[model samples]
Target chain A: MIDGYFSLYQTRSVNERKFSNFGKTEIGMQKTGFIPAIPDFTLTPRIDQVGAEERASRFTKRSIKKESKVNGLKLVLNMIDLTTLEGKDTEGKVKQLCYKAMHLHDALPGLPTVAAVCVYPTMVRTAKKALLDSGIKVASVATAFPSGQASKEVKIKDTKYAVDNGADEVDMVISRGKFHAGEYNYVYDEIAEIKEACGEARLKVILETSDLITFDKIRRASDIAMYAGADFIKTATGKVQPPSSMPVALIMLEAIRDFYYKTGRMVGMKPAGGISKAKAALHYLVMVKEVLGEAWLNNHWFRFGASSLANDVLMQIMKEKTGVYQCASYFSVD
Target chain B: MEKEIKKSSLSVSENGIEKKISPKRLEVLKTYKIYIGGQFPRTESGRYYVAVNAAGKQLANVCLSSRKDFRDAVVSARNAFAGWSERAAFNRGQILYRMAEMLEGRKIQFTDELMQQDVPKAKAEKEVNLAIDRLIYYAGWCDKYQQVFSAVNPVATSHFNFSVPEPTGVVSIIAPQEDGLLGLISVVAPVIAGGNTCIVLASGSKPLCAVTFAEVINSSDVPGGVVNILTGKVSELSSWFVSHMDVNATIYCEKDSTVQKMMQDKAALNVKRVIFYDKINWNTDEGQSPYLIMDTQEIKTTWHPIEHIAGSGGGY
Candidate 1:
């Protein structure tokens, strides 16, 4: 064995002349019928140049011209403060939010209507009634308002009721108690049950990112939700101050990407709650744009459930398109 | 694009009714048994563990495999190696090819399991198809890889030397904890492709799918006892695999360095070939291709002399 090894080493040494540049520059000798020792390195030329030379061109001009085109865009309006809307006042507040979304929809007729108007379940019927004929979708939050400490039956009933009341989509919270207790199966089961209850209504399984707290937890939760039949894996309820940060969004998007690759499932995404401005929504969109690509850019696959976000995005679009900073008041309030 | 749409429409039309009813809506309870030594036997202890789906639903009651069960699987793997490893490579390839064909027939069944795991319908279909295609890919490699890795040398010695890749004998694999079906097949197929008999620990909480795979292997002409699978605690079963002096090699898919090192250490007693696949990413091209694993096995070298005789000597 040693002799074979030594002889192989000797043969390699004899062929050292051919191995220069890891055997890349041996074509000339090969034409003379000498079998070349070539390291297999397949190269496909890229469209763009690599290295510092490419950077030099951009760095020479500090103010580099950024070119972008507007594809189809969706309005992401988050309905926060769902806590006060439960029980007796639930229907009233939901109607108010739905009316607000409808008025906003009429005002910004040229822009895409917010994909969904999310709220607590009691308001589901009110939102449905208020947004009737407006083409705006009604999304109801179930499985306990914020804590997600509820029984599977209750969550399912909540989701079913919302769906039954004309909710176009159901946004249900994962059982955080189970999720926190490391009973991921329980959380996944609850989400699956809720998804079953949704029937034709799209199910958005909210991970409530702030509760998850870590990227790995976020990823695992995203997987659990998507695996348990989530049409969309939303970040949080927006009740948490840190609604949906870019990093958290990135984590969820990556999990979705992996799920898609492994399962060939294209899950939608919604960064709800904390996104109070257009820039925040754009940043979340940018993360989605980078992580999920064009497939997740549409309303069907991507949404921002923010209430204040509609006016903000409208103002920004107006500013960019018309070359003037439109005041929040100037942009007619819905 | 139009052709693509047409093909999609055809597929959709075929499974439209089934697709309408998600597997989540159709609950089926499974009763699983231990697939040890190529035989379906109840656990030696007669104990069973309930396996939960991703949704925390009790899908199947899997056998509670014990230390004896582990040993049984190992023994079966060792016993079956003679016939399985000695089978003609072309024949083995044909068996693997047939297994893929069988898997194709069960695509709907596997897709349902994929959906139970919460895989989106579109994605579940694709993953099942990929798993089937992967089996076929490995089947094709069984016969061809021997030529690719084997070597014949022009030595300065009088003997003609040639090396041909052979099985590394009985192997033990710890399947990846996640990725129910794909992960199980990923480890099992490659080990068999190289003519090695394997005893695998099925993915916990998802053993139903693995047992289902065992059914495929059984139907595919894989000799009984060639691929013995134990579904239980890795912590409990891994020690038996690592300490076994009979095992020739072990394939570990875990990310824990401590367990990896421990497996490496225990494998040392018998001078076993310990393959720490810490770098094989299942998401990468290398992970998906069975050829990457087929390359890890050893090629036994043999020597023979080519004689030249004088015509005059032969005539005398």
Candidate 2:
């Protein structure tokens, strides 16, 4: 049943190639001394709330079992940005998380390591040194993350400090206060300045959709961030209630799709926080495949920012192999 | 009854048209769903079997639980073990006594269900009374069993060495196939009174009383997942109950030699503690004892270093 749905999207990959070529043309124009005019932020498209929820619900009903389920679970493991963004985070805790990202479960042979390790700015240097030779990247949450209430100058220096300490990617929060106060230009220019301060590192803009509270506003914020040159648009900072829901992610992915069609530029998607189960992760994967095609299936274009999701996917993979339910004590806590 | 019904029918015909009225109204029977993790849910396989009375009349449809149901039950039981085993012994005794009180309140329903399975009315009443009394008996023994079972060793060195009994984690049981109410109570009360959680397979032919008993346990102070009961065939589920790695011990109360051999062979994989109660009669006084509680417990010995006394020099 799941295979049939995936096969329907197989034919759409050809059109995805054309979309990629269009994105490259826009990037080329920017490099050749021809900058595009700023888009009208007020004209962002509105989302159909009920239709998007129904569509997201349909993705969870697919049954991926046996070999397909195993492969899908492994794929989910590889796309995780194992995170620990607590107020009590220590250097020891960061080192332990970095170790877990590289070696998920040693008892189970042939398991894939996670994509990256996400932490606070102070712990980024510790995470970098611990995961030095491994293929995993170090991502740090900065710019007064979880609440973009600091000054613009302070936010830029926060981004620069993390990048200077060997952070591969910086996750920054947008000013929701300004966005709610009818100041879309302030939010856009802030993200653009942070992107420039990142230098060679990639920048992920956190919309914190829970604070936005409406799908239309979430869609508009996604548009502003993408036009401001965000490498990836993340859902939450993992510190709020109702974080990273499926219907909310659907609207953001739709905004990315429409933006790609217009400007020929492809921006990535990251749904962080409150996504801890393997089944829900698979549903998110299904939505991505149907909405964005096969190009966004890898960790480069899509990622899960979670701390507990890696163990759940590992437990499921072990259950498939052993035909028995696993206990939480058998796995590591970190 | 017939004359009163005819009079009421004539009074209804005062209007122009006559209405036909039936004299009997059907009773709605309760659905015998399985309990897991404090919630009553039907089997995930969506299968059920008809439970019939002695006269071949259908009583209710009981959930025919599969191996997956047992697996889920084990998971719940394991999750409940830590909190249950860590509870004070006096509190566990109080909870078990509360179960006895709840069972006493619903004695008539259990008696009727037992009689439906072809048991005589006198015998059914005796079984219900015994089941309630047995719960109280275990409740009294809950706090006192540890004192009687623990020991202090006489060591040559200046150190204190002692051994105490602890719960053996999760236990699995195949309830007696003949006595549905008494056998199930006999096995489960002792296991849980000693702080261990269990998953029981009730008698397949007479499962109505087991479902009603689960309702009694629910209303009592006893926590959920401490004692999960499933109604199904023992031959189909015994292997899973015995071979599960998370199950610390298993109890079989039947006299089937073939199943005994199979249990012994399969239990070797995990080195589980397999116990049999084939000869014990549930109706007799021998059915209730502290030995049943000790069957699902493990002994742990501890040695603590101590300084020599000022004058006695550890002689005492």
Candidate 3:
């Protein structure tokens, strides 16, 4: 009787169902007017039931294998002094590092070169000249690095000059004083104007989520940057201690998911600096995959702005795939 | 034992006035009229029907009410609804309590009328007594229905939100025919309890007791014309009342299932509430409770804060 009554009610209400117009992809189609069916364990099991002895054996072996890989990925690449290079004690350090990368390129050929040789905007010319024909890109931190408390005209001029001088990417920091003062519309417009000045240069909008100190604020900053035409959303300026965490990354990924749904445009995500571990990188990657799906797994959408993360991923993957632990002494520290 | 029974003779008074041998008597007839527009006027039809005693003797010639009376009753109800619905709930409570007081005073009078209408003595007394008590039951609920049904919802932070109880105006109640006096009081009390005025159709075949119940209303401090009682065919009035666009809701308390369904179908014209009293045992003590009145009332939910946001500049 209850079933009959429910069926009657359903028949009467059949015409009332409405549809939502979002993306036209398969995921979008499934999301619109979708009611999830209750899962039955009789149809499928969620996890394999392993015995205590086998689990203990696998856990110990996994721990031992993980330790050796982390120790090897720690490459202490001494940062070149761009500020001291005004005809003062300029010792061809950029040349030395380029040559070292050339020699060590074969051993860790799969590893990424130190996230594009970061340098001062003035030394961008020197780095470009030294690293020319080496497949390495020049990344210049523009908009008066460290503190972005400058006029819009000066910031725009600074960004345009760096980009015109052949910088592949411009990592610009938001004006934290105005941003912290709840002047988000101002911050958004400034970032948009700076990105426009970059013209062909890839724009990385630095939210400094650590300084913002709240997930809600971090999420809002990510949204604001994306709305104002940011090519990529980056976590911080790498100046604050405890620069980035999973919650901050989670918030950023969620914002991207929502923004993409609204605008059908994907914004790349970059977690720069303080991301020194392979496992931490994989964890951030897992968060992205969980929230934004497999489309964000590629290099075009996902970038780790660290000098060391690529080497660590290779070390861990090699150990896991080969069933043998390789020590740190096999590779030279570049 | 035989002594001469002499004829009584009249004695002449010293002031030349004759002593009265026979006592003269006079009868003052009571006038019964329809209370309309705050005045008691006899039916314009100028026709009357007989309300006979149980011994098949004529008691009085009562007015034969017509559809015009029902329409006039509706007009009275619509006029009273505005002022009554806006009255403070506690003030309504006081008025209802006063109504109960007035009904209790006229208890013996109602019982006598019920007896004359052929109701068994105990049952007549019980119906009259319960009618008085039913008023008190509803009177207490004037202020409580709001608390029970209304709520202050925490809407997702965009604005101030609230809801409160309001009346569905001008109900047409078809009082139950079985338990005449109590049923009439039962349906009418709840409709007016929530500040809604009503035009009630008394039991057609047995309207004597119903007409007497109106006397209680007239004597009580009940606002004139808030409740207009009519004694006519249910089929005719139910059709007219149910289809009337001005009537907000209807309550059908008669027992005939066919009439119930017919009234229900006709009631759909304006979607009047056609209640079936057979579904309820009107004799049950709980049946006559104020729940009947409150259940029919629409509770509007009103919500607001008990305090205002307050702060100030001061020396720290």
Best by TM-score: 2
Q: Which regions of candidate 1 fall more than 4 Å away from where they truly are?
A: A1-334, B1-28, B308-316
Point out where model 3 deviates above 4 Å: A1-334, B1-31, B53-55, B157-161, B299-316
Model 1, residue A254: C-alpha shift (Å) = 75
Q: Better model by lDDT, 2 or 3?
A: 2
The TM-scores, one per candidate, come to 0.43, 0.88, 0.42
DockQ for each model: 0.00, 0.28, 0.00
By lDDT, rank the candidates, best first: 2, 1, 3
Better candidate number, 1 or 2, judged by TM-score: 2
Q: Give, for candidate 3 chain A, the lowest lDDT window spanning 10 residues.
A: A38-47
- Runs of candidate 2 exceeding 4 Å displacement: A1-39, B1-19, B257-271, B309-316
lDDT of 2 by residue, A189-303 (tens): 7887787788778889999999999988998899888877888999999888977799999989988887786667788999998999999999999999999999999999999
Which numbered prediction scores highest in DockQ against the true structure? 2
Q: What is the C-alpha lDDT profile of model 2 across B182-209, one tens digit per residue?
A: 9999999999999999999999999988
**What is chain B's TM-score across the candidates, in the order shown?**
0.84, 0.92, 0.80
A98-157: candidate 3 lDDT, tens digit per residue: 454444435443544443565557767767787778766676778977578789898988
Pairs in clash, predicted candidate 1: A77-A306, A78-A305, A78-A306, A78-A307, A85-A90, A227-B118, A238-A273, A263-B123, A264-B123
Listing every candidate in turn, what is its Cα RMSD in Å to the true structure after a full C-alpha superposition? 35.8, 6.6, 34.4
Which CAPRI quality tier does the interface of model 3 achieve?
A: incorrect
CAPRI class assigned to model 2: acceptable
Q: How well is candidate 3 docked (DockQ)?
A: 0.00
lDDT of 2: 0.87
